[model samples]
Target: MLANSSIDNAASQAKTMFGEELIWLFIFGDLCTFTLFFFIFGHARTNNSVLYHASQAKLNVHFGSINTLLLLSSSWFVVRAASAARKGLIQKCTRALAGAFILGAGFAVFKIIEYIDKANAGISFSTNDFFLFYYLLTGLHFIHLLTGLSLIAYFIYNFRANGITRQNHATFESGAIFWHMVDLLWIVIFPLLYLLP
Candidate 1:
């Protein structure tokens, strides 16, 4: 009975920490998808190490580094915002969300420029297997970032439009969770695509 009670309490805490079960389900499914993609990329790299390493050399590590910093900063802001929301500090939460959105936007712009630079250099989707995976992984991650940005924007707008209150704080928590998910995904993607040997 004691063991069952302890397990139930831990489960309750997890549910409370992560918010809605639906979102957790979505995150879990998305993570599984990314894991599958990671396996495929690793298998391909093992099979064609020479081509992979050569193509990786063509990628601009500078852009990747800058984007990494941006995402890390934005993720920090998201953590701040979520913490602020928990404290019922709506103003602080809004400001942090704004910071996150701006940094995330900067990441998107840099990514676009990187894509353009590659195109100008005659790199295209059909360039080779490495380039193909590069585009696919980064492009999909970019889409996820955009979605998180949109959620942040909406939360900010609703706060400003409706005036600050604790009523919708749970809603803000949901969005913040998604933003962190995107950030964590990028953390894995950065080293995998840019720094992996």
Candidate 2:
């Protein structure tokens, strides 16, 4: 009976580790999709196809740069929020969450402005390959940004109504992690989409 119990414990521990490993594997797989997209895009560029650069001139770099700053700053807010949640400081956590949510909204607004300006210039997703990928990646990222905002809002509502608990901390931490991924994705994207010649 003792031996069977020990075997079961070992099996359970191994299974838990395997589950965590699988989660990381899935995350890396998504990263690879972005990586492959950038790689192929780089290879497809033509000497005459300074079309991307020309198209970029139609973009509002000032607005794009501001959105980048907003996301980067929001990342700091979420990191503080995560720390506050772990320490069980409900007020601090709520304040940080609010700040992050505001920054996320600012990013969305700037992105909308960018879309409108580009459209007015007759540049759009259907305009060319550069615009297509820009729309696809940024649009997908916009969805993730909204999802992250929703998660933060839920955290604030739950924490206000009921105070912080282990599950609340976990949810906030997970949201921070997801939000950071969105920010980091934009770091890669901005350089590729805007800066590279």
Candidate 3:
């Protein structure tokens, strides 16, 4: 009984330090999955250097660069949002989250335009080994971006309604953490798919 009580107390302390258990679990799982995918992509690229390089050259570096910038800026906004929330600056936090969401939307628009161009040019996942990795990796990252946008929107709405307080700051922090992960994944994806010659 004493051991059980100690364990329970430790778990409670852990929760306090980690913000939320479920969010940590999800982040860990997603990171592991992305790490595996990245490893596979690297191995494949090594085996098909010429194909990968050639196909990579066909990608629009300008668009990829712009998207990277957008995501990085959006991540900054997310961080600012969380910081503002911690300070109980509801209006500042809401504006920061909104900015992040708008930047994420711009990223989606640019990605769609790039996809349309690729389709018009007859390039797709089945085009080649490089294109396959490119599509799979970037497509996955794009889905995450869309999800992050939704999370940001939800945060915005919640902030405007109830606002973030010390009691509920964990919820805001969780959203910010997820948004940073999405941005970090893109930072890796952009270099691998667009500029890693």
Candidate 4:
């Protein structure tokens, strides 16, 4: 019995290590893709300085700022939720996760509004290279935000249905990690697309 138990533990450890390595591989690949896109975007802007500045001028800082704030705040909620779950506070963790999910949805709604207003004002993805990158990066970021939110919502639903147990910690941690990645990506995106001159 002891030998069998030891073998099972070793197998579990190996699986855990493999899973972590896979996650890191994904994260690195994502980072590399974004980096290459940013490099291309930077080169285009450098060559077409006038058009880039003009495009930047048309962006609504107010809307971008609000979305930034929402995402930042949501990141905090996700972090707290993950911490609470780790400490075995199920109710508090659930509320925090729910709050983060709602805030992410709010940001998505505001982005849609901003996009509509920009389109009404004759701005679009085809406007220029700068505007194209702006739309693409933010659109990609929004997709990540929504994906993270969906994961959190699913975890919450599953937890509620099954009752929170120690096993839920891994789900909570994964959701928090995903949320932080989205927030961190936006931190890079906001300055490049909105504030940088």
Clashes of 4: 0
**Candidate 3 TM-score, true structure as reference:** 0.88
Badly placed stretches (over 4 Å) of model 4 are 1-19
For each predicted model, how many residue pairs clash, with residues at least 3 apart or on different chains? 0, 0, 0, 0
What is the lDDT for 193 in model 2?
80
* TM-score result, candidate 1: 0.88
Model 4 earns a TM-score of 0.87
**TM-score (all chains, Cα) for each model:** 0.88, 0.84, 0.88, 0.87
Would you list the clashing residue pairs of candidate 4?
Answer: none
Model 1 regions more than 4 Å off: 1-15, 164-167
| Model 2 Cα lDDT, one tens digit per residue, 77-118 | 988987776556779988999999999999999999888877
lDDT values for all models: 0.82, 0.77, 0.82, 0.78
- Score residue 16 of candidate 1 by CA lDDT: 64
Residue 101 error, candidate 2, Å = 0.4
- Quote model 2's TM-score: 0.84
Model 4 worst lDDT run, 10 consecutive residues? 1-10
lDDT of 1 by residue, 1-197 (tens): 11344345434654667556677788899899999989999999999999998998888889999999999899999889877665556688889999999999999999999999999999987999988888988999999999999998998898767744433555666677777788888888888888888
Off by over 4 Å in 3: 1-18, 166-168
Poorest lDDT segment (10 consecutive residues) of candidate 2: 1-10
